[model samples]
Structures are given as C-alpha cells and as structure tokens.
Target: MTTLSSATPRVSPWVLSAFWFGTAFHWLLLLLILMPHDVVRFVGEGQKGTYLGVLTAVGAVMALVLPPLIGARSDRSGRRLPYIRLGVGVNLVGLAVMALAASALAGMGGFWVYVLGFLLVQFGNNYATAPYSALIPQLVPPEQRGRYSGVMGLLQAVGQLLGAVTAFAVGLLKLPVLVSFALIALVLLVPALITLRGVREEGGAAVQAPRGPTLTWRQLFAYQPFLWVFVTRVLFALGQYSVQPFLQYYNADVLKQRDATTSTSIMLLCIIVGSIVSALIGGRISDRVGRKPVIYVAGTAMALAALLLLVAPSYPVALALAVFFGLGFGAFTSVDWALGSDAMPSASSYARDMGIWHVAFVAPQLSSAPQGALLDWGNAQGGNLGYTLVFGIAALFFLLGVILVRNVPEMVGRRPLTQPDGNL
Candidate 1:
C-alpha cells in the first residue's frame, strides 16, 4: 500500500481534478431532505424534531470515531488509494440502499429502513472522507491551502446547482414520497469513479495497519488543537445549522410563500451562484492577503444575512439576503477545510487529527436537534416562531465563529510558518 510518500510534492493535476469531481455530491447529501414538514411526516406522529436531530447527530457521532481510526490506519499503513476506493464503493452502495429502503417502506412509514440506509451512507462517506481528506496536507502546499479550500468551496456551490436540478426533476415526477433519493445516489457514482481514478492515494500496494488508541477518555483528550476545534465546532455548527431545518417551514408559514421549495430553491440557487463568485474572489484574497481576514469577513456576513431573514418579506427579498449570506459563506466555506488542515499540531498523525475535525463537523447534528424541537415547541404554542428563533440562534453561532477563529491565525497565505510553533 502507498501512503503520503508516494504522491508528488507539487499538486497533481489528477489529484486536483479528483477533488473537483469527488466533493460535489456531499452538500446535496446533507441538504436534500431538510424540509421540516416533510421530515416530520415521514418519521412518526410525534417525532419530527427528535428524528431530524438524531439523523443529523448520528452522522456527527460517527465522524467522531470512524475518521480518526481510519485516518490512523491509513497514515500508518502507508496506503490511502485502496481505502479511498473502498470508501467510494461503500458510499455508492449505501446511497442505493437508502433509496431502495425509502421506496420499499414509503407508505408503511418504514422509518427504520430509511434510518438504516442513512447510517450506511454515513459510514461509507467517512470511510472515504477520512482517508481522502488526509491527502490535503500531503498534496497542497501549506501556503496554498486556502486557495485549494476555495476551489473546494467553488465545487460545493456547484453541488447546490446540481441539487436544484435534481430537485426540479423530482418535482416533475410526482414520485412516491422522496424515492428520488435513489436517482440522486446514482448521480453520485459518476463523480466517485472519476475521483477514485483521478486522485491516486499515496500507497496502493503495501500493507501494515497502524494500531490506534482504544476507546477511552484519555484517547479522546490526547490532541490539543483538535480538542479546541471540536469544542468550538459543535457549538458553532449547532447554532449556525439551527436555522436550516426550518427554512421550508418558514417560507410556508411565516413568509406566507405559496411554493416553499420554489422560493427557497431560488434563494439556495442564489447562494450557489454567489458562493461560486466569492470562492474565486476569496481564493485570490487569501492568497494575496490572508485567510483570517477572509474568515472574519465571511463569518460577519453570515450573521447579518441570517438576521435579515428575520425581518424580510417576500421571496425575492429573502433571496437577496441569500446572495449576501452566500458570499459570506462562500468565503468561509472555501477556506474552512483548509483552515482545519493548517491547525494540525502534527502532520504525521494528519488523519487522526482531521478525524477530530470531522467530529467537530458531524457531532453538531445532535446538538442542533434541540433547535428544531424548539421550533416544534413554538408552533405547538400557536405561533410561527420556530424558524425565526432558529435563524437568530444561527446568526449568533456565526458571530462566535468569527471571534474564535481570530485566535488561530492564518497559515495558508503570506508566508508559511517555518518554526512549527503556529506563529505565522
């Protein structure tokens, strides 16, 4: 098996191409079934918020454990490509299973099957995610991490475009429940294959798995930056994502929009377009100036945009807010992954470290469930305050991120920090 040593120092064209192809489907996987009413109806009579929260939470919790283990094994085994291949293959199967499961038990409220498929998707996604992610530090030059992250941000925005198209087709089919999930899963395969081919992992033929820490409190608390990042990540993400679960609901009830999907779709599409623009601009900005400024600007913008939705009337105006938020988010998103790469206290343990970062990402799904429940609680109280309350909370989370990120200065621009002390 081959590991980090095998890849060329300069960014491989094939590797960059792989990133462009591989990551496009991830956003859709998260955003596709986010509608409040739809999710609630599918789960159970009294279990919408809890169901949605658990679904989101499970992904995070899995990330917490799986990625680090996979990363450690990959890093030590000196083979990344095979795991990447394996992970992609698993992801494809999981998506197919999810679609099939959802279709089979649609009317019967076969929630377990759906949940089962979702868990499979989570497993497969990180199987690839932890290993493929470790490659960032290996392939991308330290100073250029931000630009690469921007490139990723560009691809993420593009994914939203793909999702809009995906949703449109589903709307036309008048399909049974959300069975179109299968079609979406099928679409994911193309990119996975291309990426698997395009980005060759460092090791493909050697075999020697590195032993990792067993489950224990000590093992969990071993890393410093990872610990700090995870602490901030769960709190911040829960707050930021608190609003997304309710967007469709907000449009229907609070905004009085007739077609919730159409209205939100436009806003989401605008976010996609605006994000693309910001990623390009942000790439240059991070390259010329630094990542901290970009992150600060983006985080601040998110707060303002979320706050705007609180008072905005009409879909067009709301989309206008999306444009602003998208720009901010684009800047942040483009470099967010790269920032994680920069904060590594030890590159030898890159995968393990990144797994912690992944935990920061996935764990929040659970914390944010309460935010959704809060909405359900409000709605039961004879008001449409759920969405508004969530968005306000999300704004606060964004602001907090802005504050926390400043302490971790930018390492992806200007000059590479030579001392290894994290002082850029």
Candidate 2:
C-alpha cells in the first residue's frame, strides 16, 4: 500500500472543474437576483441605489472580515472541505430566509428579512470562497496553474451563460422571480454535492503545519510583489464592479430599451461568448508568454471598451462594447489567479494570505454605494449624464490598475521572482 506524500496530493482536475462551475452558478445568481430592479420593487423606487448599496455594504463588512479568519482556521486544521460544507449550509439558510421572505407569507415584512438573508449569504459565500480558492495552489503543481485557471474560467463562463439565458427565459415566462431564484440555488447545489461526496482530500496534505515564526499581517503587507498585485486587483475590481450592477438601468434609461431583461441578457451573452473564447486561449498564452503581458492587453482592451460603451448610442453598439469588455475581462480573470499563485510567500499561509488577497475582489462593495450616489446626483441634474460619467471614471480606474501592475517585478509564466542579487 502506498501512502500519499504530505507535499504532493493527487487532486483531480475534473472535480476542481466541476466545483468552479457550480460555485460560479451559485455566486453569479446570488448577486444578480438582487439587482437594482428587484431593489426598486422591494425597497422603493427613488432610493433603489441607496438601499441596494447599503445592503451590499453591510453584507460586505462580513465578507471582509470572515474570509481570512476562516481561512486561517482551515490552514491550521488542514481541512478545506469541512469549512466549504459549513459555508454551504449557512448560505442555504440565508437563501431559505430570502425565499420565504419573498413568498406571500412574508408580505411587506419580507423586505427587512430579505436584507438579513442576503447578509447571511454574503458571510457564508465569502468564507467558502477563501478556502475554495486556496485549494488551487495546494493541489496543482506550479507549472500547471495557468492551464487549470483557464479551464476554470471556461466553466465559469458556461455557468454564467446558463444563468443569464435562464434569467431571460424565466422573466419572459412571467414565473415568480422567487422560482427562478430557487432554480439557480438548485443549480449551485450540484457542485456542492459533488465536492462533498466525490472529491477526495487527504487531511494532512490539504495544508501544511506552519514552520518557525508565524507570518504577521504586517509582514504579509511588506511582501512587495504580492502587495502590488493586491493593489492592482482592487483598482481593476473597482472599475469592473462599478458598471456591472447598473448595466440594466443603463439599458432601460439610456438605450430606451423597453425589454430591459432581454437586452441585458443579450449583452451578457455577448460577454459570455467573448469571455469563453479568450479565457480558453488567454491562460495558455500567459503560460507561454507571461502573466503581466496578458494582463496589460486585458486592461487596455477593457478601458477602450468602457470608453466605447460611454459613447454607444444604440443597443447594437452596446452589445459590441460588451463583447470587447468580455474579451478583456476574460483574459484578466484567466491569468490573474496564476499571477497571484506565483506571488504567494509560502504554502503554509496560503489560505490566510489568499483570504487577504480576496479582499481586493470584494472591497469594491465599499465604493459601489458612493458611485451609485454619484449616479443619482448626476441624474438629479437632468439627463443621464450620471451613467456616462460613472463609466468614464471606471475606465480611468482600469487604466490606473494597468499602470500599477507593471510595478510588480514578475517574470513569465511559472518563472520565479527574484531580486537583482538573485534573492526572492
């Protein structure tokens, strides 16, 4: 009988791929289902942005704090799956509350309950995400990270395409929105079940025991390569997220699209198409060329896409812009993880450090409300100059991120980072 080595654990790419597909389905729906339109209906029309932003902000606070702590715990226990299951359970409870609140039994009282439910989901989702992402570096050898990231991106695009298409179809059918939500929830559960039953984890190999001195938060901050990556990601996210939550409104008010749902879904499909193509190729390109070059191309394309969207007059033009945006975004998403994985200071603190890195992903929540308020204030002056202005600013943010990324002294795919004197 052969015993598994602590340093190397056999992890199935298929299982990991399945897990990402399910998680993408779960995550995208959780965010999308509570869009500005839903908030306007539930909370109030004029204050939709405010209410949506506030709820997300509150939820984000939990997301900000929970992931790293849970990740640290997972690191110590060397058990990622247990924490993953616990997060799923917590999210289900939140989803249940949300479903019930939206039901006839809850009535207007459901609004507050919905808020509570969403916050719970945010907590659980973030906690789960931290551990789940940490698995990539733990399982895959360094050389293969880009390929795996690409495949994961491919599945993510599929899940997103399915979610968007189904959302449009469900709206056309005039089924209860809650029913659609239930369907998305059910879809999310498939991966959870696969992970629990089919995915194998050797407890000792999941994470290693900390060696010598424990890494302090301040020390983590001092790691220059990672610090730059973290900052660049935050800026990129700010640009990306600022426009995402409000695209529906842009269609309805700016483009004068009567069928906002269909329009939104169509644009999403365009994005999916571009993302699928680029993600499939971009990861491998990064592997051959370098992560930074791919990211540079992605950032440049995104900024240009945003500028185009700002001036886009018709739905067709906007649809074209969405494809460009997706191309850039897909490339970024495909290679970004490989870059971060390379920057990890050590394996022992991967979860905790990655959890901190995850903050860049969610920290956009902090600014989302303010940006929404800016939109409202601009609209108050008449004309939808607000949308144009916000998107323009978002473009600048993307450009700034592109500039900042160059500061990180990193080499080509899977190449080691070292100082001038050959020190890491």
Candidate 3:
C-alpha cells in the first residue's frame, strides 16, 4: 500500500486534476455532438437513435473489460505516466481513424468503420483513466480528498463547457469534420502533457512492495462498503446515461429545433455553467460537512430536475431544468471520487480497484442502449412517449442512488485499510 508522510509536500489540486479536463473534453465533444451528428448523417433521422445506441453499446464492451486489466498491469509494474502517454497516442490514432471514416465514407460502411475507431478510443481512454483515477487516493490524504475532488469536478465542468462551445461553433460555421476531430485531439493532448509533467509519483519501497495478497473477486465482494459505493454509482450513472445519449434527438424530434446540434450545445452550455458553480462549492462544503449529505442533496436535485424536464413546457424551460440538473451532477461529481476512495477495500490496488469502479460509468451505456430502441418505438407510436419513459426512469435511478448511498459509512478522517487496525 502506498503511504503518505505528514511532511510530504502537497501538490496543487489543479495540477493533479489537469488531465481530467482533456478527458471530459474528449468524451463530451464526441458523445454530445460529433458521434450523434455522424450517426444522423450515416443512418438517417429515422434510425439515428437506434444506431447511436448500438454504436455506444458496442464501444462500451471494450470500456468495461479493458480498464481493470490495464489498471492491474500498471499497479503491478509500479508505473502510471508511461501508460497514460501510450494511451493518449493510441486514442489520437483512433480519433484520426474516425475522422477518416467521417470524411471519406458514407452509410453503414462508414458507421462500421467508425465503430472500429470508437472501440480503440474506448480502449485507449480507459487504459489511461484507470491508472489516472488512482492519483487522488495515492497522493492526497483523506482529509483533503474533498478539495481534490472539487478541483476535478471544476475542470470537468470547464472541459464540458469548452466542448459545448466547440460543438456550437462547428455546427454554426459548418466546419469541416476533420477540423473538429483535430480540435478534440489537440485538447486531449495538452492537458495530458501537463499532467505527465506536473504530477510525480513516489518511487521505491512504498510502491514496489506488495502489501499482501492481491484481492480476489470473492474478497472484493465481501467488502460491503465498496459494494454499496459501486451499486450507488451504477444507479446514478444509469440515470445520467438515460438522458445524455438522446438529448440531440430530443431537441430535433420533440422541440422541433431546425439546428439540433446548435440547440444541444446551447443547452449544454447552460448545464455546464451550473455544474461549474456547484463543483466549486460542493467539494469544499463536503470537506467541512461530510460527503454523504452533499451527495444526498445532489441526487435529489438531479431527480427533481429530471422530473421537471419531463413536464417542461418549452425549450427555454427545458434549458432551465438542465441547469438544475447540472447543479446536482456537478455536486455529485465533486464528492463521488472521494466517496469511492473512502470505501475502497485496499490501498495497494488503487488502479485496479478504480478500474473496477469505472465499470459503474460504462455499464450504464450498455444498460441504457436499449433505450434508443425504446425512443424509436415510442416515437413510432406517437406523442414522443419514449422521451418521457426514459426521463422518468432517470429520475427513479437518481432517487435510488440517494437511498443506497446510506449503506456506505463515511470514512472521512479515518485511517485507510493499509493499517492493520484500520476499519473501512
């Protein structure tokens, strides 16, 4: 297990969280705008939702399997930055391949080619992210985790905001698809470079020695706090994914927006604004008050916002509801990493544990993939009932997250499981 000394110098939270901006930028741009736009172009409006769902679902398979394996490899090797660098290079290659498919091909052939690229992107991103997720737990003390998590949330919100702006510009100006892809690669590269340069991992005995046996699946499941955290995250993510992938379609089909891309970007801008504010506030507040209280508030806010969005009378009203949703999301994001860190059963396998935790994020993509068909079916039946059904489900998931989180006891200021007498 990695241990921190009281005399160890503290790194700035911003420096530690720098890579998150790039990560958030890459995914938000791809998921919220680029991929959806491409799916619509390739598959036509009638089947866009179904096609997009299938593509994301297929890509999610790679996302689910690769992270834990890569993370375990990095954990064993006692190295992280090299893996991050390699992952970035592979991710860029995937992005370039996707650009080629978008620019050169048409129809299902192009979509299939894009799918291959998406798989690579998922694999590469998760490869980096699994190890990267260990930084906070490895570096920061328990008392300071809330502040570090807050910084992460802040950067993520900013990244998403920038991604929204980029999407809007691309759609409004009719920029070449390659140009947008290039922008994603550029944004992704810079922050990763910064993180590689700025953050330093402790070397020698602390990292090289195995604390004990590597945790088995059975042993992992026996840790009730970790299980609860994983379950709560899964439910929260399900609610989020249910709404996220279908927003552009919602704008076009339900709101009758002529330029759905631009509209979605605008809505995202509003959401990100709310997220930024809450992220900055929520993390600091959690440090003082506790993680669960903040999470409870956040989940309720999101659940209410989801419900409100369902009955929103107009596009403007929907945008307002989106801001409310963002507040909850940002607050949740701020404390989520800290909570997971607190619940982890082992300190020696930070990356591996975090990689398994990451499944909570991608599993939802797989779970919610069928919602695309539901959206199509509901639209086919008239009144766009699919949107309502999905959003309602989202609300339910959020509420469940609020409830299940209670099972994980707060470990703030407590000694981690690395100590023989420590309790999780």
Which candidate number would show the highest lDDT if scored against the true structure? Answer: 3
Better of 1 and 3 by TM-score: 3
List, residue by residue over 35-85, the lDDT tens digit for candidate 3.
Answer: 999988888888888889988888888889988899898878767788899
TM-score of each: 0.85, 0.92, 0.95
lDDT for 180 in candidate 1 is 57
Model 3 spans with C-alpha error above 4 angstroms: 1-10, 202-213, 419-424
lDDT of 1 by residue, 245-353 (tens): 5566677777887776666666677777778889867866776777678878988898999988888867778888888988987887777777777666554566666
Model 1 global lDDT (CA atoms, 0 to 1): 0.65
- Please give the clash total of every predicted structure, in order: 11, 0, 0
Better of 1 and 2 by lDDT: 2
Relative to the true structure, candidate 3 reaches a TM of: 0.95
lDDT string, candidate 2, 128-154, tens digits: 877787777666666777887787788
Candidate that would win on TM-score: 3
Ranking by lDDT: 3, 2, 1
